[model samples]
Target: MYLGRKAIPLISALALSASAFAAQAETDLKFALDWRYEGPAAGFLLAEDMGFFAEEGLNVTIDTGTGSVNTIPRVASGLYDMGFGDMNSLIKFLDADPAQPVTGVAMVYDKPTFAIVGRKSLGITEDPKSVEGKTLGAPPPDGAFAQWPIFQEVAGIDTSTVTVESIGFPVREPMLANGDVDGVFGFAFSVILNLKAQGTPEEDIVNILMADHGLELYGNAILANETFAAENPEAVTGFLRAVIKGFAAAIEDPAAGAAAVVARDATLDPAVEEERLQMAIDMNINTPWAQENGMGGIDAARLDASFEALKAPMGLTGAVGPADVFDSSFLPAAEERMLP
Candidate 1:
C-alpha cells in the first residue's frame, strides 16, 4: 500500500522522531573494573545482560583493569567515566594531591578483601606477627600492598622486619604454593582459591583478613570522576542504581552470576568462577554492616576512623576527611538498595 504524498511526509516525520528518541534514551558510559572477568565481576555483567543498565538509560562499557590501585588514576585522569577500585588507594591519592577530582560513589565491598595468605608450614598464622622476617611476595600494583603500611601501623608490626619481594600478580600464588615465598599479600578470595586450585590443601593455608586484624578499611567501590558527576549527576545515579540491582540479583543466585561472568569470558572455569562469586559474597559483600545498613552506603564513623588509621601510615601532606574521599549523594534510596 503506497502512502499519499501528504501521508509520506507525516510517516517520515514519525520515523525521524522515533530515531531521535532511541538516540536520546541511552547515555554511553565507560566503566573500569579493578580486575579481569572473575566471580565478583559477574554482577556487573548480570546487570548489563538483565537490561538493568539499559532500563536506566545507560550504555555502559565495562573494561578490565590492572589492579585497584591503578583504577584511581585511570578514572581521575578521565580515561574512564567510572570504575571499581580500592577506596584506600583513592584516599592516599587524594591525600597526596587533593586537587584530583575523584571520589567513591558506592561502596561495593563492605569489608576490605585485603589479606595475607601463607602456608602453615611456613609458620604463618592468623596473627599478623607471623609475617615478620618472612619474604612476602606482593605485586607492586596490588591494592593490598599499598595498604600493607597501614596494616603494619594498626598491628604494631615493624615493616623493616619483613622482607619485601615484589612479584607480579600472575605468579603471586604460584610462588606461595611452590615455597618460593613464605607468604603473599592479596585479596582473600582470589589468593585462597588460586592456592587451593594449585593443589594446596585448604587446611594448610592461613587466611587472615585485614579487617579482623584491626584494619578498618573499606574495599573496592564504585568510583566516579568528579567532573562527569558534576556535569551529569543523573548518569551517576542511574549507573549506581543499576549496579545495586545487579549485585542484589547476583547475591541471590551466585551460579547465575557466574554464568554472566562466563558469558563475558568463556575461557573462565565455571566451577571456579561460581565458587569465587560465592566466596566474595560471603566474605566481602554481605558483611554484618551491609546486612544491617544495606549495601553501597558507607558508615561515617567507620570511614572517618579509616581515614585516621591510614593517614599517618600513608604519609599524607595534608588532612583529608571522609567527605574528601567519598560522596554518597548519588546513592539510591536505602530501601531500593536492600539486597534479597
Candidate 2:
C-alpha cells in the first residue's frame, strides 16, 4: 500500500525569498503522506490536480508514509519538508526529541476517524455493544491499537474478554469474513471504505464509531519541520491556503475529486478516496471553528480538548503544551479564498 513518488531532498534551511517563491510559483514543495490513498488524503490529492500547489509556486511531490509515527524524525533529518501525521505522533516526537522541531501547518480530520467494524454475519449491529467478547483487528500494539484497552476502560467494552490483532488494513476484511477475526478498530475513512470496496457489502459490516464510545482523536495534519516553517512561514501559509481550497473542492464534488485522484495512480483511489472526502467535508464543514470562522481555523478550546483527552493513557501528562504541538503562525486566514 505504498504510493511513492520521486524523492526530493527536504528543505532543511529553506527560507522562501519573495524573489524565490514570489506570490505565484514555488517549485519543489515536497509533502510526505501518512498512508497510501486513504480518504483523509483527498485534500492533498485535490491540491495537486487543481494546480493549487502550482498556483503557490510549489512543484509539489506527495510520497506515501511508511508509518505516521516515523514522519517526524524523517522531517527533522531533512528527508521531507513536511509530513502528514496525527497529533499524538507529534507529541511522541516532542517527548523523544524536543529539538526534532516540527509543527502542524493544517489539520485534515476535525474529529477522530477511529471506528470498529463487526462481521455482519454475526448480527453484531443487532446490539453493537455485544463486541465485548470479540477478537478485534488493530494495527498491532502501537498507538492506535493500544488505545483500544483505553477505550474499553471508559466505554465499558470489557477488556477481559477482548483480543486485538495488528496485521494492518489489507487483512482486516478477509480475516473477518473468514471468522479469523471478529472486528477492526481504525479509521473509517480508510478501513471501512476499503472493506466495502473489497466486496464486503455495507450490510455485511457493523461499524462502531469510537467517538460514540468516548474515544475522540484528531488525525490527518500537515506538519513541517520547524526549520522549514520558521524560514518559510509565508510559503507554508500559502501551501495551507491552497490545500484548504483542495478540501473545499473535494467536498463540493467527491466524484470529480476521485477522478482527479485516479489520474495519479501513484496516489489514487476511487471509492475510498471519494467516500472519505465527503465524510471529512460533512464533519469539517460544520465544526464550530470551521463554521464561525471558516476553513483551517483552529479554536484553542478544540485543541485544548484534544490535548486533554489524549494526555492520560498516552502518558503525556506533563509532556508538551499547545505552543509545542501546533504553530498557527503559518495557518491560513479564514478570509482567504479556498481552492474551489
Candidate 3:
C-alpha cells in the first residue's frame, strides 16, 4: 500500500512517537561493580557495549565500586539496583539482618579469589604455615581480608604468631613491595598483578588461595536488591541473561575483553588487563563445576557447608541460611549461561 504525499508527514510523526515510547519502555537498572574497570569487569562492559542489555529491554548503567565488602551495603540501601560483590560478605550481611533488601542472584566467581599473597623472598612460601610470625598487611574493607579469621581457622594458621597490620588499600601492595610487610591479604589476581607492576618478580610471589586450603566459601556474585527483584523479576532475569552473554563474549576472546576494559579506562595497560582477565576466567569464572553445570548457579550442599564454616568467624546468628541469601530462580536457563 502507498501513502499519499499529505499522509507522509503523519506517518513519520507516528513512527517517531512509537520510537520514543519503545525507548521509554526499557527497564532502567543501575549496577555496581565490586572494583574498578579492569579485566575481570570486561564482561559487564562488553555486554553494555555490545547492546546485549538493550536487546533484553534493559538500560543498565554500571559504576565502579570501592570494595567487594562495601558493595553489599550499597545494594542493601537501595543505592544500586544490583551489584557484584563477595558472597561471603553477603552471607554475613544477611546473617546480621535477614530483612536487609539484598540477596545474591548469580554466582560470578565460582571459586573465591580470597588469598594471602606474599613474597617468597620474605620467608613466605606456598605453605599456609609459612605466614606464621610474619607481619601481613590487610585492607580493612577488602573482602579477602574480611575472610582472614575464617582462612586462619581453615588453613590451620597460628594467628597467635602472625601479625596483621591494618593498612589502606592504596598502601597494601606498596608496603609489601617496599618490604614494610611480609605479606598481604587480597584477591590473588589483583595482588599478584599489582606486585608485578611494582617490579616484583612473578616467581617470587606466592599466592596462597583460600579455596585450595579447604575454605569452601564462594566468591563475588551478582546481588540484587530484594525489593527491586520482587517488583521487577523479569527485569532481573533479563539483566542476568545479558550478563551471561557478556561473559561468554569475554571468555571467547580475552584480548577483546581487555580492549573493552581499556576503552572504559584509558590509563590501563592492554597487556596487563588482558592477563588479568585471563586469570579471572581461568581461576574463577570457568571452573570445573561452572564448566560442567554452566554459570550463575550454586550447589546447595556447598553453600550449606560454607555457612557452617562462616558461623564462628562471621558471628552468624543462624538467622539466615543459604536459601535466604542466594536465589538461583532468577538465573537464565543452563544452556544460555554456558560459557565458551
Candidate 1 Cα misplacement greater than 4 A, ranges: 1-5
Q: Write the per-residue lDDT of candidate 3 for residues 219-320, one digit (tens) a residue.
A: 999999999999999999999999989999999999999999999889999999999999999999999999899999999999999989999987889999
For each candidate in turn, the TM-score is 0.96, 0.83, 0.97
Clashing pairs in 3: none
Candidate 2 — which pairs collide? 25-57, 26-57, 26-58, 28-59, 140-166, 245-339
lDDT per model, in order? 0.91, 0.68, 0.93
lDDT of 3 at 278: 94
Q: Kindly list the per-residue Cα lDDT of model 1 for residues 257-315, writing each as its tens digit.
A: 99999988988888999999999998889888888888899989988888778768888
Best by TM-score: 3
lDDT of 2 by residue, 140-202 (tens): 523345456456656766667766667765676677766788887666656666677667778
Runs off by more than 4 Å, candidate 3: 1-6
* Structure candidate 1, residue pairs in collision: none
Give the TM-score comparing model 2 with the true structure, all chains together.
Answer: 0.83
